[model samples]
Target chain A: MEEKEIISIWFIIGCLLFLFGVIIFAANVLDYYVPWSGTVTVLHEYRAGIWWGAFLIVIGLVYSIAFNPWKKTKEAA
Target chain B: MLGLIVPQLAMLFTGSNIISLGWVDSAIVILYFIFVLGIGFYLMKFTKTGEDFFMAGRSMTMWIAGLSFVAANLGSLELMGWAAASYQYGILATHWYWIGAVPAMLFLGLIMMPFYYISKTHSVPGYLKLRFGDGASMVSAVSFGFMTVLMSGINMYSMAIVMKVVLGWDIHFSIWVSSITVMLYVVLGGLLSAILNEVLQFMLIWLGALLIPILGMIEAGGWEKMVDRIHQNFPQGDYTHLWSTLGSFQDNPMGIHWTGIVFGLGFCISFAYWTTDFLVVQRVLTAKDLRAAKMAPIIGASFKMFVPLIVILPGLLGLAVIPGLVGETEAIATGGHSYNEVLPLMMARYLGPGLLGLGITALIAGFMSGMAGNVSAFATVWTYDIYRPIHRMFAKTDGTDAHFVKIGRWTTIIGVFVSIGTAYLVQQFASIMDYVQALFSFFVAPLFGTVILGMLWKRATKAGGYYGLLAGTVSSIGMWLWVKMDPTALKIIALSPYAKDMAENMYRALWSWSICVAVTVIVSLMTKAKPDSELDGLVRSCTVLPSEGHLPFYQRPVFFASIVFAVFLALNIIFW
Candidate 1:
């Protein structure tokens, strides 16, 4: 009998983080040019969105790849 | 009148929403909802058996179980309440997390896990059934089942209020959306799904909340400077000192003495909650092996030690950044910021749109997971301890495991609706909410007395256990009513006229616990003890604990617990 594959929770977290990171990072980039009217935080000059977004992207990619069910299935095959 | 104009003034200052989510932020929240449901659906295929539904098939890794254990306790209400407490009472609030929690968590890991694991009980009530018999178990199961659902309802209502206050969402919208989301996932996947999402929520909470402290520290210069700044704000206040101000009730903002801090909180309430609360212990029971089960809470304790950084530090930071935040009553009456708003206000001050959404999503996740934890535990206790036993009582034949699993699914659905009904009840009568919360302390402290005695003392009779529990619960409620009826009664129960509400709670728990132990001892001595043969795996004197000597010293639970304890001590001293 063939072994059934299970989707990893880590992969889901990674994918979600990656998507959120890209959007947040993109928002930061757009705001740099547009100067949006949203409530700018006290430490806006630090660009936390850019740094935090990049951090999430890196973590997300690492986890998504490491725990990817499709990759494990291919290896087993 | 001030009330009439206060509404207009509040709206003027607060604007439409404290936070306005961008498209990106909304997308992230939507994605979170989708992913949780996806995990639940994905796990449904593996959740066919009764064990799978109730215990996650006893297959969780230590990391997953540990994180889930802690995450289940880290409800948004706790996060916000403690943050408010840190502001109101200063760093003394850290005691609740450290000395109050860490020791109890370690005790559960080092001493208690052996019996729980070896006995193969599905719930804490189930453990009682093995040791004391049906009477004690039924009392525990019914109270736990009742309280868990009420707490879930309270959590649901709290989340709705937070959403309304923070983002201007409708209370109905928040309640229905989040409750249904929790219901769908739990009904689909059971404990495994809950554990998975709890781990995810823990991560999200960290990611979402970690920034405030990091950014706050930078803004406040450093810990030393932050302390100095706090001292400058309230020069006479002992805001930064943990143990120094704990000498007397009059000495500290919390109005608590060291004895109360140590004996009342550190020993009684902490042990009762961490060791016996099925909501958290259910997570540990998910561990794959005895070693994993034992190690789970130690890992949880290590993480729990750092929670004050996110929970307490923000309130401390608020003291430095936004002074003059009033109490809840004044905030409502005068259209001012309250201590409870410290976290949200700080988030608004630091996080812009994208990060703001993440923080909101984290809060929502905490609330939803809390609901899931309660409902899932309720389902387990209801099925194994209540429904099954009752079914066995009436029927001649035993039902199949599949029958119980089917019942568990239906119970989850029913539990959510009951919680929803209770949430509406709380909305109608807010004072009932306070009494319902008090119900927890009433049962937990006394029940802990019964369970611990039953586990440790071979002479603890079944009648002794039941009566002790009943007496403790009644005495706790009697004490609560005494304090409620006459405000002066607090002086007698708490042992100090200057003792604050928190201190009264601690001392009440202490008295009730003491009463429970004394009653149990007297009753057990008076009654016939269970035979040694009957005490086998249930009592510590009878049970043979599994040896971990074959494993390396570093891999032992004691090794990690010692390191965690060392860190806990260092933290207390540093903050002291």
Candidate 2:
């Protein structure tokens, strides 16, 4: 595969991760007001939900990374 | 008259007599000052150029920048202010943290990152100059400098009064202590010492602030008990629900109708602080590269999301336990009670001696750190943007760059005195929050007008930039004055007031910012651009550098954690 194509694929994956994380976060907020008869503990719920959202955002940023031309161009032999 | 004497009489009643006048607290404050001074003195060797003074030589790593960003933004204001809001407004006040600030930080990360990548300049104003022209840049830089000075003054004043109240020292003496400590460090080291001290101060503040809610929860028989207590004492509508007790469109405290709160708090306040404030921008500009700067605000935002757990929750708990503590209204009704004292009062009443002393010390550290951050940023702007320009324009051949650096140090000393003076003058204001917001609104709206338009609009001319800024400033001030003085406007302003003499100041600010943005855009479109030759170096800053492309990917763990945070926010907003 071409380098640009690989970069584009990574970018798309990163975006998907971010969007999914946001949706999960929005769902958690809905849980607070909706009176859902869930058996989940508050501490466990907060930890699991918040940490998961944060994890996805981090993944999104990581996956989107491409080689910077400025530093690399300077280092070329 | 009521404002002046009421506070003094209240101080007489609640003021700490056991702490003694400037003995233990004084020593702690002085030692902390000396430690900061040592950091500043150490950093002086590194202050060799304009970039070093303004942006810490642009060499700060992501972690240090991230931590310091949180520390600087948190300050005593966040500690005291969030707690006070929670004490009065209930969990709804947490909206400022969760909905307002966090999203703004993320938006800044996603959308504004491209600008940071393009504008490699040390100051936001410099970036504006590159994007628009000299006129826009100068107006922004000047207004920002003015706003910084105003805010620093208010912060110093509030900190001094808190120390005076908590430590039983004279207000004048408290001011002197606060001023000297901050000045000693900031004047010497500039941005480097400020960031370093902020990192340390953040730890102290977190430790101090976090203990309050945890201890309060335990004392009130844990979270369930605390909630029960709140439900019992407060009306059914006021207890757990976020929006139930909040002042409606017709009854806001600061003239902010419900819609105003939605826009002003949700958009204007967040945008102005995160996007336009030089102190925040300075941190971003000092990052090692574009990617670090872009990521830094997100980290700060993530931290902001959790801040309510430490700062705001304790205040709500304090409200639940302390009967009749119905927000700042009841607190202020009992003559001489300041909203700033809510957290301190809770500490004194609930916490035991050892922990109480430690907590008070932590609060002091938070206040000083904030003051230090302000002074350091003020010094950098004064030196780089103002004094250096005058020196070059006037002295030319006589003054070398080193001479200007020395002048910068002197300017910091002057800044300290000015801030102290402003603090004393600001005492007559209604509330700390009102005074700070009003001051910021006056300066920030106009500057935001110029910078935002300049960056986004290619047709934005120097003439248009100047006119737009003037129009925005004039209209905002006029609107503010009308709300204050004009009977018709006052009635509109008073629509939100719950009781007589209760002012809701938010309306003026909300309207003012809206007017500013509108005027800037309209005026910029009508004006002619400056010559391309004159705009060359200025616009170059907005051109994305090749180095930006080399940025590395985020770590997998961090990516995963961010996803979790988003889920938490969404669930809380939807269900709670």
Among all candidates shown, the one with the greatest TM-score:
1
What are the C-alpha RMSDs, in order, of all predicted structures? 3.4, 11.9
DockQ of 1: 0.44
DockQ of each: 0.44, 0.02
Which stretches in model 1 have alpha-carbon errors above 4 Å? Answer: A1-4, A71-77, B1-16
lDDT of 1 by residue, B139-193 (tens): 9999999999998887787777777777888878988889898888898888988
Taking all chains together, the TM-score of candidate 2 against the true structure is: 0.76
Q: What is the TM-score of each candidate against the true structure?
A: 0.96, 0.76
Per-candidate chain B TM: 0.97, 0.85
lDDT of 2 by residue, B465-532 (tens): 77777776777677667766755666565454342232333445455566766776677677666655
Best by the lDDT measure: 1
lDDT of 2 at A71: 25
lDDT of 2 by residue, A1-77 (tens): 01111122224334544553454444444455663424243233333334444565576556444422322322110
Enumerate clash totals for all models, in the order shown.
0, 58
Candidate 2 lDDT score relative to the true structure: 0.60
